[model samples]
Target: MSTPGEKPDTRELVEADVVPRSRWRMQLVWLVPIVALLVGGWLATKAVLERGEKITISFKTGEGLEAGKTKLKFKDVDIGVVEAVTLSTDRKHVVAKAEVVRDVANLLVDNTRFWVVRPRISGGTVSGLGTLLSGSYIDVDVGNAVKPRTDFVGLEVPPVFASDIPGREFTLKSAGLGSLDVGSPVFFRRLQVGQIASYQLDPDGKGVTLKVFVNAPYDRFVKGDTRFWHASGVDMAFDTNGLRVETQSIVSIIIGGVAFESPADSIEQVAAAANAQFELYATRADAMKQHDRIVDKYVVNFIDSVRGLTVGAPVDFRGVVIGEVTQIYTRFDPEHRRFSIPVEIQIYPERFTSRYQTGRAGGRISDDPKGIANYLVENGFRFQLRSGNPLTGQLYLAMDYFPDAPKAKIDWSRSPPELPAVPRTLQSLQDSVTRLLTKLNNIPFEAIGNDARTTLRTTNSMLSKLDADVIPRAHDTLASAQTALDSANSALQPESSLQQTTEETLRELARTSAALRTLADYLSQHPEALVRGKSGGQP
Candidate 1:
């Protein structure tokens, strides 16, 4: 404070600088806050940049899916996000671009599945509320180790969560439509245990092939003799009464399923070297094949047999449906040099086999030649044509087996009884009708016309006789009898004096005849009738 000049403060300033002043201050007030802000900003960017393994998923439709907002989740935890959406080359599928966190990469196996988790309410479960928040996404599931960068198939529902069981892949060739599709369920003992992986047709177009995957444990129970059948869609039928059809939930319809039954004695494992081909039979097809055996197939060569045939007509073996007419067709047989009809029939052999097994060793029930001969000797087999539908004029084949009658040998040298060669199915009914018309043309028209004329002439002559001669004669005879009765009644009337006199004379004659017997002895000869006739009876 001594002087305001600089020269005066130099010593004081120097002394103050050398010693310095102990002052209280806030520690890093601005710098601390700035450093905190930098650290927080850096952490936020790191969190946003965190990424996952990328994968591509495909779907049939992308109606509700979104790219940026859609999140890939596993067990309710967000594992990845959809990065982009694009159409496949075929334009039939939606390809979803997804990125999964690196930590989950080891879980991505070949068996991993991706399916859209949409809002679903079924039997008793509801899921997919997150989908409503950010749209649909390709949900992934980690499976066993497999090839890297594998394809992720978008499922319609969660892959049936199951462990790998002992199973085999079989290819089935079928003419009709398959009962299963990709993702269809495979049932064991009526329980859902497996699913169909894929389906396609062979290159030659001969049949369809299906790939099936079965879960373990249950797979051990399936044997080589296991039978599989379609368990989809309700079979529907309608009759004159009302509608008859099966109904099921919408989910079961879209996903075709299968059911299997294992045979009692079948082994657990199938033959490993057996061909990959497996045979599956529909209910109707199985029944049809069973009918093909045992029954004798015959073709009718005459029109009479065909005109009376119809669908559901009895194809009987002794009045039984041993077989049925399945098909009939008319075509020219190039080898035969003539146009002919072919008939196909299906027979059930079980009927005969059952009976054959029940008989003694030497009995007539066996299929052996000797047994057949013995059976024929004991029971005669014959066929008789009978009317099936009287209104439709349809005919059926009936069989008669008579155990009481003696068997007759079939005469192979001579032509058998003529029958029409026609199919018993609906399609062949038309051809049968045509054959009937042709047979009618062979009748003699002139003979029929002459017989009709003769019948008419005889009827007219009889009518004329009854109207003229016979009727008049009966009327005249009745008139004469009436006149005679009237004359007799007139003479007997009491009002006339001659009637009273005749009555009195009849009474006197009765008394005179009683006394005449005694007087006749004295008179010797009393000729009363002769005297009366000569008018001398007055005495």
Candidate 2:
């Protein structure tokens, strides 16, 4: 249909179209560099935000940590990832290089704590149970300080969860370290509410010092007079009451625990502040024993034998326990060459203070230290040792009205006022015997023997007369009576009732005489007993 350049053919001819290979190259070619730059810049920005900060952490051992796999967590939330794990150049420790997100990187402060979290059964608690399936992870504890840090040292054992809890801490002094560990549970009425934070030997080496933490609401239960004791493991004991086994829980039986209770007298109490000091008793009994606060101490020097007296013996006031014996020892006086038993007693004056009413124009103690002792002295107060159990020979000190007690005064110069002591009951008996012997030694025995010999002579003379005269007459009468009975018997039949009766009467007479002789012999051997009944020395 196309025509040549002739004018006539112009109407029927058409020129061929000129089309480029592509036109898209022109518009998109410029856009290629711009889009690429924009995309590359976006990727760079993502890398900067997500790439994280690389920091090394020193561990006792690499343990469950791995490169690019172990993740760091805070409060169970993922916060960082481990990039690499390797042993230090010296091989003294393992160092892990971890990448922490920028958001949490500032949390890496001097006070921050980190440790590997794994399946652990500690302090009566089972933790990290999820690690059983998903494997172990690094646990982090953040600090309030925002000062930036990179390098860190990890805790071999995870820090106690109680450290992160909102509560108060206290110090417990114990006789010695028992089954308690760093993470031992602290119990309130056998309920798990806190934990033992740490423990160490006391500086004076007298006991162990323990640091404990109690969680928020439970911490309020800690009053100024709270008492703490080791409630760890199984307490198995056999006493007069029989077998007793106590445990806070099954977990406490295995891993140990600590427990606290309000003081015996907590009528007026206040919440104890953090770092308050308390005594951690060894057992429940000891803890209860500590319920009484020591208010007074006294030393009683007794001249009597302290055989049954021992430490921990009860000290009573009118049969009511007011104190306990703390010590009993004897010291020899070099100058006098005499030994005296010094017994120490701790008195709880609070007992009397609680009994009296306040602000009623009532009796009040004097400022003078010897005021009470002086008043008691006027009231016939004296200390005496009495038998608590005669069978066990256990003796306890008793303080009561002893009006007849020898007048004495307490020596107040000593720390424990020294109240004058009297001899024990048994000692008093021995003293009485010694005094009797001393008086008997002064008697004129020779003159008394002469008088006794004279009396014996007179008694012998009377007996001789009775034997010489009364015996002949009595014998002749008996012969006469026997002759008469024989004559009567001959008159009667051989088996007659009169002959049988005569024989029976003779036998009875013989028995009576024998009994009379035995009685006379007994009287002669125990002349004083006839008047004094019987002596204790007699069988």
Q: If scored against the real structure, what TM-score would every candidate get?
A: 0.48, 0.69
Pick the TM-score winner. Answer: 2
Candidate 2 per-residue C-alpha lDDT over 57-175 given as tens digits, one digit per residue, 9 for 90 to 100: 99989879989889999878898888888889999999999988888777888788889998887666678899989988999888767687899999888777624679988999888
Query: Candidate 2 — worst ten consecutive residues by lDDT sum?
Result: 356-365
Model 1, 107-168: lDDT tens per residue? 77887878888887532235777677666666666666677764686876654443343455
TM-score of 2: 0.69
lDDT (Cα atoms) of all candidates against the true structure? 0.61, 0.82
**TM-score of model 1 (CA atoms):** 0.48
Candidate 2: residue 117 lDDT (0-100): 90
Q: Return the lDDT, model 2, position 24.
A: 54
How far off is residue 13 in model 1, in Å?
A: 13
